[model samples]
Structure formats: structure tokens, C-alpha cells
Target: MDEWLKAGLDYVPRWIDYQVQHFAQPGCAIAVAHQGEVVLEAAFGTADLSTGEALTPRHRFRVASHSKTFTAAGILKLKERGLLRLDDGVGNFVPGLHPDIASVTVQQLLSHSGGLVRDGADAGQFTNHRPFLSTAELKADLVLAPPYGAAERFKYSNHGYGLLGLIIEAVTGEPYTTWIMREIVRAAGLTETAADIGLMTGGTLARGHSTRLPLGRRLVIPGDNLTNDVASATGFVSTAGDLVRFFSQLSPMSEAGLLSPLSRRDMTRGHWPDSESVLDRSYGLGIISGTLKGWDWFGHSGSFPGTLSRTAVFPAQGLAISVLTNAIDGPAQLWVDGIAQILKAFHAGGAPHEEVADWVGRWWMLWGAVDLVPIGGKVFASPTALTPPLAEMSEIQVTGRDAGKVIRASGFFSPGEAVARLRDGRGEVSEIRLGGTRLVSQSAFADELVARYQGFSKDRA
Candidate 1:
């Protein structure tokens, strides 16, 4: 591994673990791949809060809406085999459809520009108020005319992907799940993936949890319901490790990939802007794309009732990252972006030398925690609460064995102030002093709080 990548990977797990504890999230899983090889796989917190089952990298998550990417790949694979074309009308394959919806081509549906209904009028299936729609119910909903014209703009529609599922069934004389599993998922060399919950076998499935606001406490949600007909849109289950592996192969720069270079380019090209949103993102064929830190990336995000997940592939950097969180309000997107920021910072700073290597540790104060991270021979005092911890960070220039000076920081922070590491009887660093404020180990801080504020000894408390 490159020294810069190694430096970033070394701190990613520590940062994520801190975030999980500080935010009280159910659990989070993360995986990263570089040049088609997985370099890191990690998980934090519990899979089921009721049982306290520790989340592991092997645990599977209901990666809803990522199923659309798989469905799009299946359609493109058929096109590669001369079985279908991107411009073919849906009405040609599926017999019954509203004229407007039927005229929507396969490419439009892939790009979410088909302007089909977002979901049928009664979308109780998503909320667990009712089971997922069956074939009969889905067909009944498709009979109605779409609210917008085909190719009007980027209007998201789960029903459009469902229609693509029916089209897959029509093109091949097999079920959507069966064909997609064999051709797309397996062809991409993924083992920890399934088209739907019913087909998921082996490995532990992480149970989802609701947010703690309205309920005052999290309740376990068994996210194992089967999506009957809409499985092609919102029914795929996978691990963070497998998700990165699968998405890495979708990069156009990848030499050995499932699709041809032309198909991959067309699929990932930003075709329609999300004009209604302020995110400055665009929708591609089965892909969502944007620029971060001057690097263009393409991937997908998924939202199930109890889970939120995201993945991003940076073709220029040859990197793919996936984050899975087993809670409705999990900050999966923020976590992924933060990881990218950390990597970019490390890449710019290079590797740390032995002089500052021992300066690494997470120290706490009354307000929150601060992480002393060593990168490129300098120490960075970063706050634990921030999504990208390096934001507004203080740079320390080590002057001696146990002394440093804060050379760069915000105006409110102690810039150009003396910093020192206090040692215990055994000569181990026990506390740190940044200017006038003192920070101690987490355990010591907790004990101090109980003893001073609560008026009780550690054992008594």
C-alpha cells in the first residue's frame, strides 16, 4: 500500500468507532478497495441492540435501491449479447402499460428520466404497513398514466425500475432474481450478495433500528421482508466488502470489468441534472455522480426503512468505498465523505516519521474529545465530533521530545502556544496540555467527572 493510503486507513477505523459511540448509532460497517483489491474491512457497534450482537464485516445489510444498479447491469448485459437495445420501448417487452410509460425507453428508465410515478399511490410496503407489492398489484399500478412525460427531467421512480424488472423477465424466460443473480452479481465475482432477502443465505444479517427521537429509544426492526415484484429496485442485500468489490468493477478505468468500456462510459456519464436539489449532483444510468475535492465520482446510495448505505468509486484514484449503517438516521453519506476527506488530507501530507509517531492518541476534555493524529511528521489536533475531523484542525510542530507548539489553528484556538505531554510514573503519556486547557485519557476524564461533579468515588459510583 502507498504510505499515504496506509496513513489514512490507520485512522479511519478509530474515527468511525468514535463517531458511532459519540452519536449513539446502532452500528456501521465499512469497506474500501484499491485497484480491485480490498484493503480494509471494518465494522463497529452492535448488529442487534436487543441482544448486543457485535456487528462484523461479514454481516449483510438490506441495501435498498442499490438493486437498481444491478438491474441496470442486467439490462446492459442483455444488450451486449444482442438480445436487446437501450432505445427499445418498454411496451415492446411488457405487454400491458400506459402509453406514456410504455413509450419510455430503457435508457431513460436507467437514468431516472422516464418520469414514472415515484411509487404507487399507496406505498405502505416501504413502511411495513403492508407487504411488498406482488406482480398483480404492480401491474395494476402501472396501468395508470405517469404524472410526467418521458425524458422530461430527472424524476426518481421506483416503479420505473420495477418495470425494468418486468422487461428483464420478458427478455429472458427466467425470473428477474434468478437471471440477475447468475449474470450480474456472480459475474462481478461477488459472493456476499443476493438479489432479495429470500435468497440471502449464510452469514449474519444485521437487524435494523429506528431513530431514537420519537420513540425515545431504538426498537429493533427485522429487515428481512421479501420484495415480490419490486425486488429489482429495492431488494438487494450485501456487505460493505462485497458492495465495494462489485462497484469497483463498474469503474470504466478498470481493465477487467463486467461491461465493455463503451457501455460503462455511457452508464456512468452524467445524463440528467437533479435540478430540484441543491446538492449539485446528476443522475446517470443506474448511477449518481458528483465532484468532491476536484475528484469526480460515481456510485449509488440506498435507503431502506431501517438502514442507510452509500458507495462511491473514484476512477482517477482507483479507489472505491462503501459504508453501511443499520439505522434509519445513520450518517452513512457523511461518514463516506469524511473518509474521503481524511484520505485526501493524508495524500497531501504524505507519511509520518518516527519522531511524531508516538504522538497519536485520543484525549478528552469536558466538552468533547480531541484526536492527536500524526501525519507527515506533524501532529494534528482534530475534534472527534466533526464529520471531517481535519476541518479547523490545529497543526503542531514538535520542538523536543515532549514539547510542541501549535503553529496553525483558528483564531479562537491557541495558536503559537506551547503544548506539552505529561507523563506518569512509568514515563507513559497520561495527559496533554494545549495552551491552558488540559486533556486526559477517556477513563481518567470519566473518573474525574464522577468524583468532582457527582461527589462519589469511582468504586462507589
Candidate 2:
């Protein structure tokens, strides 16, 4: 890995952990891929708030609308095999659509321009207040008169993708899930990606939690609500690692990518701007394409009942990141965007620019841990707890062997404050005292913990 990328990867976990805790989310899983190499995979917080089961990278999230991306790939694959065409109308294969609705082309459905009702009046399936739509139930809705004009503009319609799923079956003689799992998921080498809720089993499925609503506190959703016939539109479970791995291949021109380059270009190229949206974002064929950090990228977001997920693929950088949250309120989008900004800042100036400062090291105190971090040739004392991840404690200038004095630590210590460093006879740093806390060396951490317990015991009521 390049030095800048390696350093940026190190920052990924710590920063993400800070944000995950800072937002007090139930849990978050993140993964990053650089040129097909999984550079980082991490998880934080509880999978089940009720049981307090800690989450791990293996945990699965209902990557809801990400299913559309897979479905789009399936359509393109069928096209590759001469089984279907993008211009084929929905009525071409699937029987019994309203004449107006049936004539909407395949590309139109993939890009959400088919003018189909999104969920018709009962989207309660998403919240488990009602069951997810059954095939018979979905068919009833599609047969109704078209509500919006075909090929008019972008209007997101999950039910349109559902119709596409039906079309997939009509053309392929195989269920959508079976074909996608074997052809797309397996072919992409994604072991953890599942085609639908029914197949997401035998592993750590993250229990999604509700956002705090007008009723008051957030509650845990069992997260096993079936996606039913809508799996092609909203049902898929995966890990962050698997998500990034899959999306990285969406740049089909990339090495060993699954989709034909022509298909990928058509899918990723923006087809319609999300009206009034300031982000310069547009909807493509099952993909969200836009500019980030001046790089044209394409990816998607999934919003399930109690989960939120976001992904991005920077084809220019050969990089991608996926963030999944078990909580409805999780800032998966913001976190992913922050990561992209961080990478841009690191990579913008060409090389790593300056070397890591000499003073950076781990330290221990009664409160917890603090890290002396070097960024851009300067040191900042970062408290692990009791402060944000990179809160400044003090910047110090070396004064003697294994010793330094405080130059400044905004909001923590005064300028010229003594940052006394005590060392063993071997000239190795043993402990550091600053801001009325003694940070013991790693070797002495056990002793400090013992002393902390003793202090706790003495102060007990």
C-alpha cells in the first residue's frame, strides 16, 4: 500500500469509532477496499441493545434497496446472454400489466422512470406494521391504472423494481434470488452477500433498532421481518466487506469485473437529476451516481426499517467504502462521506507530504487512554474517553532524553506548562505527567489499573 493510503487506513477505524460512539448509535460496520484488497473491516457497538450483544464485522445488515443494484445487474446479464434487452417493455414478458404501465421500457424501470407507484398506500411492510407484499398482492397493484406518466421524469418506485423481478422470472425461467445468488453474488466472490431475507441465515444478523420517535425511546426491531416477494426491490443482507467488494466490481471496466463494460457505463452514467437536490446527484440504472471530492462515482444507499446503509465507489481512485448501521438514526451516509473527504485531503497534496512526528505514542491515565497523534507534522494529544477522538491535550517539544515540555494544548493545558516525562534508567519513557494526569507507559499499565481499582475502592460509598 502507498504510505498515504496506509496512514489513512490507520485513521479510518479510530475516526469511525469516534463517530459511532459520538452519535451513540446501536452499532456500525465499515469496510474499505483499495484495488480489490480489503484494507479495513471494522465494527463497533452492540448488535442487540436488549441483550447487549457486541457487534462484529461478521454481522449482517438488511441492505434494503441495494437489492436494486443486483437486480439491475441481473437484467444486464440476461441482456449479455441474448435473453433480454434494455428497451424491452415490461409487458413484453410479464403478462397482465395495465397497457399504459406495460409499455414502460426496461431501462425506464431500472432508472426509476417507469411511473409506477412506489409502494402504493401501504408501505407498512417496511415497519413490520403489516406483512411485506406477496406476489399476488403486488400483482393486484400493478394491474391498476398507471398513476404517473411514463418516461416523464425520475420518480423512485420500489414496486417498479418488483415488476422487473417478475420480468426476470418471465424471461429466465429461474427465480430472481437463485439466479442472482449464483451468477452475481457468487461470481463476484462475495461469500457473505445473501440474495434475500430468507437466505440470510446461520450467521450474525444485526438486530436493527428504531430511531427515537415521538413516542420516546428507540426500540429494537427483531430485524427478521420477511421481505417476501419484494426481495428484488428491498431484500438483501450483507456485511460491509461484502458490499464494498460487490460495488467495486460495478466499475465493470475494472480488472475481472463482472458486468460488461458497456453495461456498466450505461448503469453508472447519470440518467436523471434528483429534482431540487443540491448534491448534484442523479439516479442511474439501479445506481446513484454523482461527484464526490471532484471524482465521478456511483453507488447506492439502503434504508430499511431500523437500519441505514451507504456505499461509494471511486473508480478513479480504485477505492470504495461501505458503512452499515444497525440503528435507524445511524449516520452511515455522513460517515462514508467523511471518509471520502479524509482520503481526498490525504491524497490531494501528492505524497504523504510530511513524516509522522517523532512524539506520537500511546499513553495511559486513570480516566482511560490518550494517544499522541501526528498529523501534518504536528502532534495532538487525543483522549480516548472523556473527550473526542482527537481532542488536543498538549503539543510538546523534546527537552531531554525521553522527555518533553508542553508548548500548548488548546482548551486543556496552558502554554509553557511542564509536560514532565519520567524514564527508566534505560532512557525509555516510563510515564508522562501533564494536565494533572499521569500517563503511564504501556509496560506500567497493569500497575496503573491496580492503582485505579484501589482508588475506586477507597472512594466507594
Using all chains and alpha carbons, the TM-scores for the candidates as numbered come to 0.97, 0.82
Predictions in order: lDDT: 0.92, 0.82
Displacement of residue 455 (Cα, Å) in model 1 is: 3.2
Residues 108-151, model 1: lDDT tens digits: 99999888888799999889999988888888888898888988
Q: What is the lDDT, from 0 to 100, of the residue 425 in candidate 1?
A: 100
Prediction 1 global C-alpha lDDT: 0.92
Backbone clashes in model 1, listed as residue pairs: none
Q: Model 1 — TM-score against the truth? A: 0.97
Q: Write the per-residue lDDT of candidate 2 for residues 291-345, one digit (tens) a residue.
A: 8748777999999988999999999899999999998888887888777766764
The candidate that wins on TM-score is 1
Per-model clash counts, in order, read 0, 0
Question: Model 1: residues >4 Å from true position, as ranges?
Answer: 456-461
Total clashes for model 1: 0
